[model samples]
Target: MTTYPKQALLLALAAATVAAGLTATAAPAVARPAATAVPRLDWKPCATPGGPAAQECAVLPVPLDYDDPDGRQIHVAVSRVLSDRPAARRGTLAVIPGGPGGSGVQRLAQKGAALQRELAGAYDLVAFDPRGVGASTTARCGLAPEDRYLTSLRSWPGPDGEITDNTARSRRTAEACARNGGPELRSFTTANQVRDLDRLREALGERRLSAWGTSYGAYVAAQYAQKFPRRTDRWVLDSTGDPDPQRVARGWLANMSRGADERFPDFAAWAAHPDRDRDGLRLAARPEEVEPLVVALAARLDREPRPSTTPGVPLTGNGLRQAVQNALYGDTAFPGLARLVTTAQDPAGTPALPPELAQPLRDEDAAVMIGVICNDAAWPHASADAYRSAVRKDRARYPLTAGMPVNVLPCSFWKTAPEDAPTRITDRGPSNILMVQSRRDPATPLFGALEMREALGGRARMVTVEQGGHGLYLGNGNACGDRAVTDFLTTGRRPTEDTHCAN
Candidate 1:
């Protein structure tokens, strides 16, 4: 379910640097060593067209591989909007974006105005695109268009729960990445991103910084807090996943089955509501009937695929299933899913494919996503027999997901193994982190957020909002939930105990 922006501005660097044939300076093994001397950034007007007029952009040169610090170099694109009132400014608040491939600069443009209004001039808003993202240095896997489709990349099992096609696709994808993705792709790890952020801290010339990290970014922020305990202030982890180093992304993908099942009820209730009748979006007479109707519709589509608005691309059962998973993320998406469902069930209706499914993803976006997970941790290269058995069980247990969450991925055939282990999130950091997670998030559910909470222990206080969505603050229209996080950020006040915003 992790997707990247398709049309982000790809600003051109004056020159993408390449350091040739020199042995990198190795750091001391006693403590975390500096990757390389932080490069001084020359800030200028950002090239991203839609960003705030006040925002400034910069390029940061980081080692292609930290262990080979002086070797090849790549640029990380960063942006910042200074405090409107310098006299009232407290410090810098870094905005960490989600998706191993999410763009921080773009997010700043989208949220910068609200963030400025929310905090007044308390702090400067700063963000950056991690390696292999946005205007930063990028790599491509040279994957064929078919392999880049959203459905192909998501590892959805074939018809009748068969995974032969998925298995072949996985191998093909990994092979493509290995053949075309060089050291640039291999360096896209969560650990490296943490390192890059620290280097950014040095460039900003700050001893400490506050942060608001969402989704996968939360993991990076947490890791930063763990690695440089004294450097972080007032950290916010919104909609984070489990930090179990052993499972990592694999555990995250596997858990989505349960998450989807939990959040589907919200969609069902919405779809069955009388309010939807006016819009011709109501799917069933009762919430209980919605699930069966969706399930049956998907099964029927498996037998006779429906033509979509996208030429040559038909809506299959898995397409319906993916739509269900995507819709559960937020209420804003419910109408689309309802409409798509109605369209599929209608004899003369033609379905419109979601933008994500309309075409292939950019190679760099796919590279970063696949690289981070594959290079961060190892995946099981289980036999086809083993996979078939597991997929059968997961499908039976969580039919809405249709075993896609637990199916094979390119990680199973990734070229490079992780040089270091995944960072195990622990409670050994300053007690300034506040976590806000929805009670039922399809992407990062309550069960997983609890795992992050437990891992952080005394260092964090969690606010569970009684809402349904992927993000908590600024996501669901839950004022109480938003206020809780805002109060903590603006005034350093918390509920004193892990509490729930039942309203």
Candidate 2:
């Protein structure tokens, strides 16, 4: 499988809306002081292919550390597609992107039209590039190019699930970030993102901001809601993961094993179907046999790696395992994975590595992925023996992930502790939250979403889409799921209780 920062990739695999109306959610009467003087955004025409022609972009300046507002500052790139009908505009709707590395401004470009169409002219669609991401102030770890490969960044265990090399890499990566990341890298925590968001709200001069957050973005949005509950209007969390304050990003990583297990059946059925025969991609005669076939093939590759389309970067057993894990994120990736498996199974055929796996990630991308996860909370300083034991057990329980989900990461060797404890999500907020999740998301999973729901207590309602993918709303094309979320965003109405949508 392709490697990126494990947490970011986990979030990327796991990855809308708003509405308007009447009074929006009433903000608390308390007068809250702005962290700093909110600057005027000089919005200018910024158009991209398929993006709104009227989309405007600007930069919002925010402190690198909220505690030290007068210290240093950085700019967050912001974009907005203003409501076409200003007379009907309700408020600003923020589209939070997944991945510690996901570019929110780009996401606005990608999804702005659909959002506008879905909600009519009710709200201004807006998003931003968080610090260390695209079009914003960026920081790099000065990592060697070789160390930036997805496989290199993700803690994929040794061929036998041993974690010796993984431990060494973790130490090396942590040291590199310490050496070159500077304070900006240290500032890339979820808390800072929330602070940046609040600054965005203040800059927009909106008393309340509605938002749609997906994957890791859901966690950020949840934190925003927790810290500044009354500042939110309609909130939509898509494909949420567990927000256990204790585990934080670590829990999200570990949950992927279950996610993979939950989603594999869907792929197995597809790969075994007769349709695959026409494409010469069928792996087995039956769905039951697909797992074993893949398992056996992975083991064979482990023993003797196969040459790949990328010279000198042959496909390893772990590479195949990563491919399988990534392919489970969406149905569209099924064919590429099926073909890769078939090619790897061929003794004389060369397998083509997925594009993500074929090249190393950029230094900034790697830095942002590692920065957010590590900065969010402290990872356990488990001994090498502990990591080995965990990997062995996880590999046995979740072979599709091959222990990667539970494997050690650079966070394990992070020198700095989290500045603040992970924000505990709670029911103390407004009851305006709507969560839409896929039943078999290979990154977030249904069980994790349940944990988030339980965390929110009575403050939220969930729409369980009976699907086998990562994202919902405007993704996967599930009419039932889409309608439920759109209805909530556009009309401020939610299911009275938890509901399920048919596939």
Clashes of 1: 0
**Poorest 10 consecutive residues by lDDT, candidate 1:** 12-21
Per-candidate alpha-carbon RMSD to the true structure: 6.6, 6.3
**Estimated TM-score per prediction?**
0.92, 0.93
lDDT, candidate 2, at 194: 90
lDDT of 2 by residue, 304-355 (tens): 9998989888898878887887777778889999999988887888899986
Any idea what lDDT model 2 has? 0.81
Taking all chains together, the TM-score of candidate 2 against the true structure is 0.93
lDDT (Cα, 0-100) at 122 in candidate 2: 91
280: Cα error in model 2, Å = 2.2
Residue range 1-503, candidate 1, lDDT tens digits: 11212111110000011000011111111222345665777787763455567898777777777777877667788889999989988889999877777777777876787788788789999988888777777789998888866677778888779999999989988999999998888888889999889888888998999999887788889889998999998999988888899998788788888888888999999999999989999999999999989988999998999999999999989888877776676688888899999999999999998766666667766777778888889998899888888899998998898888888888898878898798788888789999998888777778988999999999999999888877556656388888887888889898899998885
